[model samples]
Target: MAEQSLVFSFFLIFTGAAILATLALYTRQPLLVAYIVLGALLGPYGLSLVTDTALLADISHIGIIFLLFLLGLDMQPSHLLHMLKKATLVAIASSLIFMATGYGASLLFGFSQIEALIIGAALMFSSTIIGIKLLPTTVLHHRHTGELVVGLLLLQDVIAILVLLLLYSGNNEEQSGALAFLKTLAALPLMTAGAFLFVRYVLLRLLQSFDRFHEYIFLLALGWCLGMAELAQAIGLSAEMGAFVAGVTLATSPISQYIATSLKPLRDFFLILFFFSIGASFNLALVDAILVPSLVMTALVLALKPVVFRFLLIRISESKKLAWEIGFRLGQISEFSLLIAYLATSAALIGQEASHVIQATTILTFLFSSYLVIFNFPSPIAISDRLRKD
Candidate 1:
């Protein structure tokens, strides 16, 4: 019966998603928003067709790992390093300004100091999925704007991982925060060394030997990605970071493009589940209580992020048009914000109200940002004929 229910739930989700996605395309709406709405309608808080969101969420997280892995595969090591170096100062400066904005706004809304701090931290990152999803692959993939956006997002991902580590450490009475920090610091070099050694000595040789077998190559790529992810988790680092490293190590391989192309549909499948899980997990009943503060914070994030990013990018010698485009492309709070809120609430570091506030704000930004990008820029689902690009 339990197995039957899980299968039934997936059937409903995919069926509903297809209908909604088609309607979204006809109506010139974002398909991501349609998936979220479908989840909200069918999930626990609504009609209750699917009640085990936690299980779905766990499965959906693999989507993020795959997303990061693909991102790494696309970037050559030298190009990635150059972009990171150029964007580091801009990323840091923009993050500090956004954090201060969030902190001040939360305090003004009567949140506790710790709650404000957590909220502020959550505001520091922009949505990687939305930013990359909306970008036209042909124009942005190798363009200057793409490089800057990717660089900043990568730095933010590192900061988010460290923040998560701190939250985890805080939950354990026996663990010293400094020790956790040092462990994470140490894990970077260790993971890099391990990835390179394995790729050079084992993975590349296997791929070379089995180059004729497409199916075998695909299995090997999945194995390599998941293996690194598990290894990273075994250490103090994040699985996403590890998956990225796995991809990076294989970036120079002749078969990297084949792997990337073959795995895209698989990646998209998991990502749909991920976006649905986001909507399914939220409880609308709690939103009313945090509505006022949440709206204020959301508005501030939507407005200030672009301005801050543009200013910083311009100051760092980026072109005005490029700066503005990158800024607007990143003008939304990240999915990591939702994760931070969940972790803080679970750890008893913040109240349910605060968590709800963060969730609501993140969703609001996701909705608006997607529309903004779709209407104004070149996207896969752009409303305008001229702006639509593959």
Candidate 2:
């Protein structure tokens, strides 16, 4: 197919997404799964209608940045820290188990040790998008369960940032990954200090002065989000993390809710592109090669994550019901998992075969896990009227 104009691309993508989404709703499937399937159907591996996937992937990442930002806007710094402390051991313990599971599965499939390690590292996270989006505010929000779910996810995000940092420094032959990790860790306090100072001095004043200008408020929020994202990247942290800090800094502002509410539509728009890019980038031809290993790993993730999480949470004195709920809610491979595959490939630490295995497994788990959650839980988009809480 010929390259399409930018306008035409948007037209085609959104239109296709809407049609597929309607079908998904009618069929009682998740809208996110529809987005992924649409991408697979229209992307280069399928029909090649949307061959320009690189740009779409880049745009889709902003959705994650904004998602974290909105998440920060809702969270209190002190509360986050307290929960992070409680969640630290759980995240670490669960990640090690998941990582080992992926490693064994990859090695069994004849991957090199390094490839298996990278794959294992990739498997250590769950999809924040799926976890957050499917949660019903009316039922889960403001509850201890909601706090636990959000805290665990945020803790996982921090771990992902460190993983990405290590991958990034792997690109620099002169720098050791451990040293880079320390530098990034040290810089975080400075960045946090700077963000708080800037927000207190400049951001608060602007919000107070222009409290009535809807347009100005919108522009300010967007600029602050992206600016913080850039700053985070500058300091070796992920843009998503930076955006989250930006939101956290403004969490105390009366206008923070307004900014969050306004930006959600924008966040949803970009997230669609993100999920689409996941599907578009997948190479269906590799399915035959990676099929067995991918399925095994997907099954491992689906089965192991819930059990481990539930056990750990229960051991920590959490109720079995809430423990099980959060466990199922987080039982999928994450977008960060895809990023690790891409980075490891870029760093020449893994081969195309290993990367494809990770991608395929992540997508498969995303589809199946989403269905499991919606079918079993109270979700905003659950098909069952009794389970739908939005």
Candidate 3:
């Protein structure tokens, strides 16, 4: 009876996911949103269809691993380096600016100082996954707005990775703070240099030899990603960072696209599980305590994130219209923000309320982003005109 119950729960959650996914497709909404909604409906907070939340949480880690791996496959070390120079500067400036703004807002809204700080920092990250997905599949990705958005998103992802590493490694111990910070700072350079060297000298040669064997190439890529991810974790770097670097290492290869496509199904599968776990494991008590604050946070993200993007792009010589359009395209909280919230919770650096706050904000923002992007093209000047009025 016990085993049957567990099996039944798994089937229920998976079935809900599948059914909601189809609904999402039909409605032109993001599948991510559907998964969250489904999870919430089936989780203990609702229908109580998914009783083994811990089991789902454990399996969800695989999604994170594969998510990072796919991200790695898409990044080219050389291109990433070039993109990083601009991305780093922009990411730092934008993150600091927004963190201050968000923190101030949180304080104004009566949150505790520590909670405010966590909220601000988590809000700094933009979602690479959501942003990229919202982009049209046409040739526009090569355009100015697409390119700028892509670069900025990449920059935020790198920053998010570093933040996760330090926060988690610190173990919430005041004594470990300095060491963890220093270690994280050191790991970035080492990882970058190491990935470049490995890809240029080792991977390039290996890839050349096995280019003809597609299956071998795919398996090799997979092995390299997972192997590096474990090594990175052992060395105190993030598996997410390691996987991203792995992808960047292969970005210059002719087979990069093939690898990305090959890994897509895996990435999608795991990522959906990740999002579902997020919904399933939601802390229900937060609904009453954080609801108002989460709404405020969501509005800030939706309204201000794009404004910052527009200002930066315009400063960099992009046309105002292009900048506004791109900014509107990014007007949402990212998955990384939720990930950071989770890390902070794990480190005891922040409360579960903070995690719930971020999760809700991200879910709300994703819903808004799906609508904005899907409608933007049909009403091209709609967003830009509104910006003008404001």
Candidate 4:
């Protein structure tokens, strides 16, 4: 089949999304879920209508970068630092528990040790896309909740960076590999400091001077966000992480709210594509082969993550209700999990079987965990009108 043009793909996706999203709302299901199902239906795996998976994936990622940038606009660096400090123990403890659960589940299905290792690593982190996208930011209760969720996710992103570094470094010479990875890791702090300086000495002044030029401010914000994202990638960190940093740098600026509000619509557009790309990229053919094992690991993660998080959080003196809410919000596997599967498979570290299992399980958990949060919590995409805060 010929690959669809970008314009045509957009048309198909939005048109299909509209129909499915209406059905989703009528049935009181999350709109994000509809986006996923539409991807599966029209994606190469389902109908082969949209065959340029790589392009779609790349374009869709801007959505995540924008999401993080917008999220940062609402936060203060001090609050983020404090929350990260307070939540460190919970993040570490919860990751270990979730890792063990995934390892055990993978081993139960007779996957090799390496396969289990990758799966376990993938399972430890929760979906930042879902965790933040669904979270409502305007409300008081949710604002507090957002701080905790963002903190834990940031910590988890650090761990994920380490894991990706390990995955890319390969296993030829353990000691040298570790040293080389550590060397690259040193760039993160330096880059962050540089970002602060750039934001303070350059970007803020531009924003202040151009505040009256709404169009210029919007373009400048986009340029700053994407420029930082690319720089972060060059420095061996994730683009989304860089986008978050860019947002946080401007968090103190007076125009942050305006920037955040303006970028939201564009963010939502890309996000729809992001979720659609996810379902499209999934191979339906492999689902049956990996289904049983994927289901096992999926159940373990979905069941244990929330409970373990809640337990650890309560032990750290977090209120019971809020802790439980955080737990469920973070109950799914992450997009990093999908990235790991792809990188691991490419590196020949894990076989197709294991990769499929990780991909399948991650998507499943995305589905389940999204439903769990939307139904029970206040989110921008909540099914209940009262719970919807956007």
Candidate 5:
């Protein structure tokens, strides 16, 4: 009976998603928004068709790991390094400004100092999913704007990982904070080096030998990604970071493109679940309390992010048009913000009200940012025929 219920829930989710996706296309809205709405309507807070959201959310996290893996597969190591170098200053400067903005806003709204600090930390990242999903892979993958956007996002992801580590450490005794941080710092380089060595000595050789067997290649790629992901987690680093390294190590392989193309459908399947999980987890009753602050924070993020990013990019010698485009493409809070809120609240470092505020604000920015990108830019799901690419 339990197994049967789980299967039925998945059936409802996919069926509802298809119908909503059709409606979204007809109504000129992003499909991601449709998925989220479907979850909200059917999930625990609504009809309760799917009550075990924690299980679904855990499964859905693989989507993000796979997404980053595919992205790394598309990038040449040299090109990635160059882009990262150019983007470092922009990322650092923009993060500081955004953090300050969030911190000030939370304080003005009467949040405690610790809550304000956590909220400020959450503001430092932009949504990787939105930025990459809306981008037309065929067109933007080779463009200067794409490189800059990808570069900045990567840099921000690194900072976010460190912030998460800090938050985790804060839950421990005060004396353990520095030790925990140092361990994370050490783990990253060690993981990178180990991935490189294994790829060079073993993984590449296996791939070379089995390149003609598509089935075998697929299995091997999946194993490599997940293996590295588990290894990273074992070493106090992020699974996503490990998956990315797994992809980058294989990027120069002749079969990397095949792996990327073949895995896209698999990646999207999990990603839909991920977006749905986001909507499912929200508790609507708390919204009344957090509404005003959520709206204010959402507005601030949407308005200020683009300005700060554009200025930083232009100051670092990027073209004005390209800078502004990258800025707007990133003008939304990240899914990481939601994770930080969850972790902090669970650790008793923040209040439920603050967590709700973060979740609500993140959702609002995601919706508006997707709409902005779809209407104004070249994307896979652009509303305008001229803007639609891929």
Candidate 6:
């Protein structure tokens, strides 16, 4: 906690993360898992090398805001409409299914109603970051498997945003549920129209005028993300949702890819810190209390989530194999799940033990998912061989 130790901790943690991430890449695993392991080793549970995790958590949270900004820059409304129905249906169905299963399992494990609900919602999201990163750029992503993954995860992101909104609204004592829900609902249209107008008139025009100025574009992108976040808070909506909406609004811009590419390094840096902070802040004492629930949740995610996703994709006109592949690739839990769980715990919407459960489940699913997706890439070929014999 001292000034010198604080400086030393930051350096050591990030350095360790960087080295482990490199090794992860060499071994064909996602860097996220590496980051989590680094956090576990350096965090309270392990070496206790870092003491000011709270400060790091706050700093890393800005990465979330920035990430949403870049995501918004690419998510133009017209683009969303192209696959709106499919995205909406898949996201809704899968999220509901996961929530119900997750909630039931949590209660069976002895969690309170509120904790169960919070953890259930947290379990509803799949890791877009890890999913996309693990996906093969040439075959799986461009083919049916990739599209299904994108559509399903896109839907989950929207639902996650909405869940965060509801949680934020439900926190206050005086606000009636109906009124709060109404307020949240009303803000959506206004937010959309405002963002649309901004993009159509302001952002696009600015890009045209300053296409060469990457620096200015970057600043504009950052402002757009945080600005929308602040605006959402002012209007009784969740800032996180606002940031995601902002990303979706910019989805169709020709400059979207450039913005994403340019900002990716920055995103990675923050995410490293963000995930590390997640591990460091974890309370080891609660691990014993939630171990069974965590394992149950992890099993559900690892075994059932992909099956649900695969079924949904098949129902929506995708090939069985591609759908199955997509499902397996995304079967793991996500970083967003951890963030929501943490927020719920911090806000007392969920219990501390529940937060630990989410953390453990997330890490478990992450490890297993990476292995299943990355190492099992050759399995699809084996499936084809079996079909040939049949």
Candidate 5 lDDT over 151-185, as tens digits, reads: 88888888998888888887688778887677878
Candidate 1, residues 54-158, lDDT tens digits: the string is 988888889888888887787788888899999899888888888898899989988999999999999999998888878765665436677678889989988
TM-score of each: 0.97, 0.96, 0.84, 0.96, 0.97, 0.84
- Candidate 2 regions exceeding 4 Å error are 1-4, 138-142, 174-176
Residue 292, model 4: Cα distance from true site in angstroms: 1.1
- Candidate 6 residue-wise lDDT, 93-194, digit = tens: 888898999999989988899888888888888887667656543343344444456566666765776676666656666466557667767887889888
Write the candidate numbers in order of decreasing lDDT: 4, 2, 5, 1, 6, 3
Q: What is the C-alpha local distance difference test score of each model?
A: 0.88, 0.89, 0.72, 0.89, 0.88, 0.75
Worst 10 residues of 3 by lDDT: 381-390
Span of 10 residues, lowest total lDDT, candidate 6 = 381-390
Q: Give the runs in model 3 whose Cα sits over 4 Å from its true position.
A: 1-10, 64-68, 71-76, 136-147, 169-175, 346-349, 377-390
* Candidate 3 vs candidate 4, lDDT winner: 4
Q: List the residue pairs that clash in candidate 1.
A: none
By summed lDDT, the worst window of 10 consecutive residues in model 4 runs over: 1-10
* Candidate with better lDDT, 4 vs 6: 4
Deviation of model 3 at 179, angstroms? 2.6
Cα lDDT tens digits, model 4, 1-390, are 234488888889999999999999899888888999999999998998888878989989999999989988888999998998999999998888888888887888898999999999999999999999888888876777899999999999988988998887785578877775776578777877898999899988888787889999999999999998999888778898899999998999999999999999999899999999989998899877898998888888888888898899899788999989999999999999999999999999899999988888888999999999888988888878888896
lDDT of 6: 0.75
Instruction: Write model 3 residue lDDT over 1-390, tens digit each, in one string.
Output: 878986787688778889997887776565667888887888888778787777776666666666666655555455555655655565678899778977998888776898788788888877665666555333444344445666777677667766675667665566576676677678867977887798889888988987999898888888888877777777777676677677767777788888877877777666666667768777676799988888888888888978887888677666788777777777776777876787777777777776788788887777776677655642221233332110
Ranking 2 against 3 by lDDT, winner: 2
